[model samples]
Target: MAAVEECVVVIDGANVACQKDGKVHIPKLAAAIKYFRSLELAAGRYPVNCVAFAPNFWLNVKPSPGSAGPKENGTMETDDWALLNQLVHQDHVILTPSQAHDDFYVIDYAVKYNGFIVTNDMFRDHVSNKRIFHGKRLTSNWVRSHCIDFTFVGTEFMPNPRTMERVVHFQPSATSAVTTSSLHDSNDNDVEAESDDVQEDGMVVDHKGTKRSKTIDLSEVTYYKVPRELLPMLHGEGGETMGKFQEYTGTYIVLPSHAASAAPSTSNVLTLSIYGPEPSRLQAVGHLDAFLVQMQQQYAYQHQQQYMASQVHQAGMYPHQHQPSTGTQDDQMMEIDPY
Candidate 1:
């Protein structure tokens, strides 16, 4: 027999969404699973030798009576979100959490056999540079390194998309009320209204727009507004105020937290260094198939050798011992003598 290349698809049961808005959506979930299975078939037909499913702990839980929700059943929620959160903090192979129960057991078996992980959650933040595919397309680098591919064909949720906007802040003094009559008279007089644009500091209003050119102590400012998208990436101008902008903003930013660990390996680095290089999908598939075939052959050969050895030993030791002699009884008795 040939050695089988192992592959495991880790399903995030929590995200499976058997129900939505208090209504059963069984057909949707089933359709999603069917689509995922199709992708698995494609993988197996090419680079993958064998495929297994990694079920999450939540799948074992039954719905509770009334509004109590899913029964605890002594199992922890080993869903994709929780698993990814835990994996980010680990270095190498670590035992799945106890709450995982059977889910952990199954995952352990797959990892032990060098099976690849198939998950949709961006759990590979710690290893972001790894390559991960969504179905047939390369979706993320994180998945590529730690596992094989991430199939997005069945996902129900897409990460929230962000939009950018401009925000303006007013100084405390600028907020003071200005009489409407005084503003009208100033415009009517057109006496080159004292330019609001101050040479160095303070509030300044220009015909183009009211431009505030003064630098006020940040401590004096009561409130400020900043674009939501820019808020995450902003750093203070001076060393003293660095990261201060984020402190004032309630929202947290998502940045590459594991760039160092996810750095490409020597082989990957070499591959990338080549300029104007085009990736060859066929070549990659061929290489993977060759490896899988070699492993299968080695395993088969070892099994055959062990079986032959056992057969030879059994044949040599058993039949002769059971043989009965026709005239040997008298001869054997005659040979018996005191030493």
Candidate 2:
């Protein structure tokens, strides 16, 4: 039987190729993502399947065949360079560059836009980390927050970020009130969900019994149903729809994606929570841009080893051998290993 495909897998390339056991091989993680993605490659699906992000340094640094750290080489020929070139040619397994620590961009992309991530880093040390989960239960206040399932490819178990009973909110169906009940019970809350105005009979309708909008609040977690053309490859039993996330007992299949109210198109998205509400699907990713600025401040640069490097053993540390800084320019990424 052929292996089934799953959701998009975003990678922190440096995080995956950590040198913990000995000298870690750079291509091992690249091959893993490529192997899984190849199992489901097709049109629409796997078009840009496994997206990997690494610091630009990896493009030039040469790795000794058996050593852990990257060394400077006059020639650009090495296993690391070859793997990156292969990823570029394949196109499906795309490799991108991060302005700073690749981990932050990885976190932002996976949480805000894509639904699945593959890295051992859990960034709890950064103040920015609080913005995503904030110690909340891994259920959907919107869909299921803190519900990102992590896989180290060879880890023994999965993640459940908190102790609270997980809450799951399914996509409100067009015929929601009637069908799929045999599938499972809906969330038992008296306050009708703001997303879908549920009638006393659990029928979805507007106050006038006319308009049927499914747009969700910015504060809520919900899923746009996977497109009809993309569903088969994305939600197969063996796919990564649930990925490493532990399934709460009440729910089974991930309900399909569908058209929501005229909210912004998710072409290029931004994820944020503010004192006031401002949402834009096409907003330039200024948070990371701002973060990069903060990291480059004079005080931050000289004192970075004292402040940031102290976080090496903290959660969300970068998973690679440390590169000794030569203070070349404004392109240094946080490198440490704890998560």
Candidate 3:
């Protein structure tokens, strides 16, 4: 009889630790993992023939007395360590030796075994330019090839990524959603709409008045006008001092939240609803801030480079006639007497 081909998975044990109200909830973590495994079995998929790399403390440490397990007939029993030990010994999950670079280890195993990786990390956070090849390897090998996303939802492990549409976004949470083998899913479908040359009193021409940007041909695109007070907050500038334009009413700014087809207008201030189940939100404010800051930095860098080049050229043209200026180089004109 031919032996069944093994279906292995490389799990990031430490990454799967559950959190509740911002701290690790050991019992919850154990319960969540159990739930995660059950789902796979129910789907007729084999349990992970896998290695879980984590710190010694994580794999072996028992929770404090009365700190874990659910009440059983009016008695709370067992902690995460007890649970971990059982799972490790009985289940197909093997506890790997403690390692600082466990993520890399997981990636290596996946590559060697032609297995899938199960973790929320993108492998980018731990990588630098020095590890460019390593990063690329992890991304192309594990992420692109096969990735089983596992997330802890409320009190249980959500094994299927498809059901993650219900995960609330942006809002503060004890534990944010985690995807095991995701690449840089840049939710930046942002558009930087150019202000039409015909601007009178700061209002850009809505040339195709009420007509949406062509890039996204959505059957329905919802736009929301930010509260006049929150207007300053959305200006990309630190919402500190008010700009002259911000103090007035009717200075409407639209935030594109949900679109049936694609993202909003080609305007810089936009965000994506990447997590699906279309949130009734105006935008992902973080993306908006990022887009604005990036644009500002690019613009500043361009001007600075231009200024430096001009200075170098001027000095080269008149090497002998060079004289130190009284004011800063940026001060093109000195404060001189009108006389």
Candidate 4:
């Protein structure tokens, strides 16, 4: 009998473990392995050759009393220790060093095996860095094709076929040519609309007001407004803040330098064009709001310091005016100088 070729897969174990409502459930990792193995066998798509890479922290978790199932313990569950041990025994689990990201090892293994990746992570930060294998660059297209996403329905593993397809694509308005990736070099000066500028409705209006249709999927884009003053803080030093936030959320965030908005309005706000899944976009929004609160607090503290400094300066200039009354009422009244 001829030997069947193996279909290799590199699973992001940390990503898989946290698949259930953003909380780590070790059973999900076990279920994921079983699901893939069963799927390969059912489809007869060659013997499943899969390996999952995880951080050492998960490997160190101690299992508590449970019926070999998921048990909620604070933010994570670890009752599936038996399954984890089984995977380890089968040499299916690989643990990354402490405090090191498993993503690097996962992608490395995938490249070495020329295998598929299974994770919901978009890997936005790593995708741009070219990982060439078999003459194929691990670009957005490659990721979309090779990555697998899944969800859990009451501990039942349900794989999603349309992996990363729902991720929003970005298109800059006609008034701006800057995208999220190039936010660092973009000028923060107000962007005046050119003769031909496109609006949110995908309508390109010329200086003469002749409107033409431009194809854009508005559904994929999310628009958020922040105070114009926060542009510096939001962009950070060389767009560092925006870059970190984007990397953290796996989303693209562009702040066009204009009053230019999705709608024609004269508001003192800068519109943030965010591109990603809905959950990612919402997460980005929360981050932005938190940043805003922090900036407001800093500004308030600075204003208070300035106010105190000014008060001290005034007191120094008019020392008598700041002195407290030290005399009796009658003495103080006479000291008022009834000239």
> Of models 3 and 4, which has the larger TM-score?
4
Residues 1-339, candidate 1, lDDT per residue (tens digit)?
Answer: 223432233333323333434322223333334443444333344232222232232223332342344433322323433432343344211233212222223333333333334333333211111111111111122122223222233445322122000001211122122112112221121122233112212323242321111111111111222222222122324422322322233111222112212322222110101101122223333443464455445555666667657766877889665455576656744553411
Instruction: Estimate every model's Cα lDDT from 0 to 1.
Output: 0.29, 0.37, 0.39, 0.56
Model 4 per-residue lDDT at 199: 40
Model 3 pairs in collision: 119-180, 120-179, 120-180, 191-266, 191-267, 192-266, 192-267, 192-268, 193-266, 193-267
What C-alpha RMSD separates each model from the true structure? 28.6, 19.6, 21.3, 17.3
Order candidates by TM-score, high to low.
Answer: 4, 3, 2, 1
Off by more than 4 A, model 3: 1-4, 20-23, 26-51, 59-62, 68-78, 126-136, 140-145, 162-339
Query: Per model, how many backbone clashes are there?
Result: 12, 14, 10, 0
lDDT of 3 by residue, 169-282 (tens): 111121111222322222212121222122423434343431232122111223332322223344445432221222221122222212211221223333222111123122
Compared to the true structure, candidate 1 yields what TM-score? Answer: 0.23
Q: Candidate 2 vs candidate 4: which has greater TM-score?
A: 4
**Largest lDDT belongs to which candidate?**
4
Candidate 3 TM-score over all chains jointly: 0.37
By lDDT rank, best first, the candidates go 4, 3, 2, 1
Model 2 / residue 227 / CA error / Å: 49
Alpha carbon lDDT of residue 237, candidate 1? 46
